[model samples]
Target: MTVQFERRTDRPDAEGRCTIHLRAYFEGQRLRLVTREKCLASEWQTDKQRFRRSKQGYQDANDYLDSLAARVQAAYRQLRTSGIEHTPEELKAALAPPAPAEKPKPEPARMLVVLFDEYRTAQSARGMRFNTLKTLNTSRNLVAEFAAKLPKGLTLAAYDMAIHDRLLGFLRHEKKLAQNSIWKVVKHIKAMLAYLNRDRGMPLAVEPKQLKAEWVDVDKVYLTAAELATLEAAKLPVGLVRTRDAFLFCCYTGLRYSDLAELREGNLHDWSGARVLRLTQAKTRTSVSIYLTGTASALLDKYLGEGLRLLQVMANQVMNRNLKEISKRAGLRELVEVGDYRNGQDGQATGAQV
Candidate 1:
């Protein structure tokens, strides 16, 4: 077997660049394979079968030709050692640059619900709050339900404007979810998708930012100072006293349920002769310092002698259920209109007693 470099001056490209080819001769057959090297017709030396010295990078070009020739020779010797009958075509094939590996058909972008679960698992591992994880689980369930209703099923690649519209329709019409509830679900979905895209390197059909939910400010529900005093004084149930105390503490300190659940005696401290509650918020992971009001301090002192946790707060769901009963027993019934808005339009207002 013999191999040599040959510049194709007969067919220069429009840019006057001649393709350098590897000419291989095996037995009596000849084969030519294109080399990646290119140069002008004047830059090639026919007799030496390499680039002229005047050519830019000529030494590198000649070295490449030598390496390619050596590779072809090594392939020929290997074929001879194997004692297999081979053609010039086989020799050329061995010398030919390998076809670019088909880019691994990019691991069929994970199914939407499956990817959501993965995101939830990652968040759980990252020590996300229990309530937040629960919310994510709910979002995953909602997505699975919506996917079940679809004809072709859901996928990250299939998430587009039409799917977005269908999801909103399913939540609003079929599931009969309220505007704020729908917003929360959509927000969770966007968050998961964004996390997958940004952290997991998953491709998204549409930008997460483009998937928008029209959020409306729901009217805040709370008790007035007089009503709060009435409930604080009128509560009588043995089981509900802890729940009421926890709720009253939240009202006094404006702490979220998550922070209230995690509150401990260590969080209470003396600062400049004033007692203060210091804690890092679970959801936002932001540190906060709050000067405890008299009522708040009293509630903390009332719970300090109890079990391990500060207030021994029940699960949020249980506490909420008990709070309703506590409110009814406390005679804190004042009808108030609960207003909700959707898509910049006023939604129906429901009346509830506080």
Candidate 2:
């Protein structure tokens, strides 16, 4: 019945570290706990705390301990109410088939480490992006870390949707994760399920398909002709003129930046009349056969001749920066703020600039 969190602020690191610990005592010893460190230097900007690989802080540490207490308390309550006291390890042993009559050939248990490796290999074969793969590995590491805080038998896979909802709800509400971010975690869960079912040959882990993607009403805003013209005329950084053109090419072609980056000379259809670009989109695998529009054609004519990278557009950050400003200048039903609804390319008012 005891659930508690303790915080200890110490000057262990230059940034002022806080040890936030949450532990549950089920049978005298701590059953489960979570501890995290954060930096106080920046007034605890959460994204900064997360994204920056900086030092830890006392307040953030205390906060982590508090959250861990809450989660362990919830988990403990559910176990008590449902009468599910056996750890997954104990349950596994309980569910294990009886010692066979003739002493069957021994097959060792599949270690979690082995399961994780197979999961990564399978994901690689299935075409996961490097970053996506990296995120999955991180999630797996987090799960392992959290499980270790519990007993040896904490089976996350055995948890039902109720637990999933509890975890995600706490993550979104108490932890203040955006819906999109929770969905990012959901993606990791899905990857783990894939590893479990397809790779590990396990059954009845949390079903990911039952989980919905976080809803977001998108306001698609591509540049308009006048806006594009204005953007084209805008001052450039040291070497970003080509990058702008390349992004513009994507705007016209509906190709993602990934597809745009990988397009090669070999894919360029020179044999066609008047410089048509023939290529399949990297993301959707949809083939695009755009027969040179006047401006887009001119861009290809210039860049293809020089043999420069189609993506030499310094970076996507610059593209987004310029686009945001350009949208504001064009005044699309008022300047496009971060969350404002703006018309997408499909239907634009006659004078509307992006």
Candidate 3:
């Protein structure tokens, strides 16, 4: 049940890599592995693949490596108890850390809080979306929570893969998060690690990857032509009819919900003194031109509200609810099913799904 450590240089196919940092070889075999910080976000310690970098990541990496060392040793002991070949190298490599980088280079001293700000600014410059940035912000909070419990002067680098995996695993398993949701948190951590590597030149022991989870189907109303007609015929609630018209406008113009909600007056023009609706979608930021349908023309001509926009985008949710109700009242529910069952995956941008 004995587990002995080796310098990676002592192992075959792993000589002078310096990246292996730590190892557990069995009776002269590459039994298993443990890792120390070789670079920022690089953890060579555990079976899990990724480790994000932090300013004071070494402290964390060491603690992680130590825990893994214990686990590998125990597993070898268990094999002996079970009468298996307790080869250190074989078992150890199986439990070895994920990766390695160059040793931690020299760096300027700075607070974790300060480095976090730097990371944020750097990622933002990388053209990250707001939602993505928000997730990173959340991951940052989780790190803070863990950091808070540590003694003063403790740096985040003082942690390792075991602790990082524990927290991330909780987010994935306990939170029961979807791929997209988990991706957000992990991406943020990875971004910070990247910053530490490039800016501070810290070597990491792990490279974080996307969660490699699956996306799910969205239950949604895609909209349809017949449903549009039913909507037109059905008697409607007062302002909701306008909202319905706006959503219909979305269907035809392909404006994102945001653009439809925020469209201003100046974006439109007159064709021979007649109104023409034109605006750019906020989501994709693409400009759109729509020759108003007769009904749409009427809504605009009749209720060209003081603002340049046709409908206030603020009330979109209420509008969708009312529109759905209008559809049900007009008996368009069947149409939604018909459109989907008919076209299957071929239904993108079709008026049938809405």
Candidate 4:
């Protein structure tokens, strides 16, 4: 048998670096194994079977090739001394690095829960809102539950469309959630996976197209002009008065809850005898100028002397609950189906309200 270092000229890496292999010839058969050294073909010496001392890593490559050659020769001598006949494949196997101690496959990477926790921490540090964070936590919990059901559990390497398809089926049949709600979960999953891959330098197993969420068309409901007047004239209880006023102001000026909560007297201006509120949207950070209606102007007048926050904004849950009561008291029981178009209202408006 004969073993020699041969440069592989046909296959080159992305950087045009060619690898050298130990080619074994015996009994009309040949076998080859990579030597884990790479360089330009021009930097190699054909007769010397080593890299020339011309490149940055040439010395280390030469030493490694020498060590590999010694191992192959030792394997050949050992087989002959033992009076055993071996094929080229057997010699190559004998020269291999003792089967690498058979590592336990690296424990199958980390659990998805760990990555989700890190993502939540980073998001909180970046000032995500409480409601948005809460929704993401819900999604993360669902993902954890899904992972627990699997035999191998979840890891970044196992995030593929198969898992996604199964999760969609679980959300639909097992959790009995509608497409819209399931879409929310998928949205959070896509965002978190993107953060891990693009932001945190983790590799994802699935393509971006595989992670796409299906959009749903939702029916929106709005208060008609008559309902608006009823809400304005309704004598709400002391608790709902703030929420009622805020809701009415939103209906008039089309200000989002985030922008309205942060609105102050400083945002109000007299633009050629017209009262206008100028501020940047908290969600998008875009500048906005809202001309006030008569009711909007009156509502601002009521809260003008308030502190840094122009209005008394309650927790989202409290505000939503109180608005439901306000709707009942306004006697606008008619189911009003509204479109998704904002016209000039808040950009995030998409749902229906009575």
Query: Which residue pairs collide, candidate 4?
Result: 220-338, 221-338, 221-352
TM-score of each: 0.55, 0.45, 0.41, 0.54
Q: Tens-digit lDDT track for model 2 on 3-60?
A: 5544445544665744433445666555443354433444333432231324335455
Worst lDDT run of 10 residues, candidate 1, spans: 335-344
Lowest-lDDT window of 10 residues in candidate 2?
345-354
Candidate 2: stretches off by over 4 Å:
1-117, 126-188, 203-205, 209-213, 239-243, 271-273, 284-286, 301-308, 313-354
Q: Best candidate per lDDT, number? A: 1
**RMSD, every candidate, angstroms:** 13.2, 27.9, 24.4, 17.0
Per-residue lDDT of 1-354 in model 4, one digit per residue for the tens? 677998888999998889888887767877688877888877889998888888688877778887877777788789879887777767867876665566566545967777988898899999997657876898898888888899989887888888889988888898776677688888888888888889978888886557766767654556778888888899978888998888788778767676676787789899988898899776566788988878788987787777677778876546766776777887877643212224454233322345
* Per-candidate count of clashing residue pairs (backbone under 3 Å): 0, 4, 56, 3
Predicted candidate 3 versus true structure: per-residue lDDT over 1-354, tens digit per residue:
334433343443432233334445656565544454344223233343224344346567556756766887787777778887666544655455668887898765454545676787777898876544654676676566655655663244543566566656666776555555555566666667677877778665555443233434445554467656666677777756666666666665545555565667677688876667777544344566777656666655655775766665444335545655666766775433211121124221212233
Q: How would you encode candidate 1's per-residue C-alpha lDDT over 40-99 as one tens digit per residue?
A: 878888898989887889999889889888898898887788886567766766766799
- The C-alpha local distance difference test score for the whole of candidate 4 amounts to 0.77
Clashing pairs in 2: 38-56, 38-57, 39-57, 243-313
Winner by TM-score between candidate 3 and candidate 1? 1
Candidate 4 lands at a TM-score of 0.54
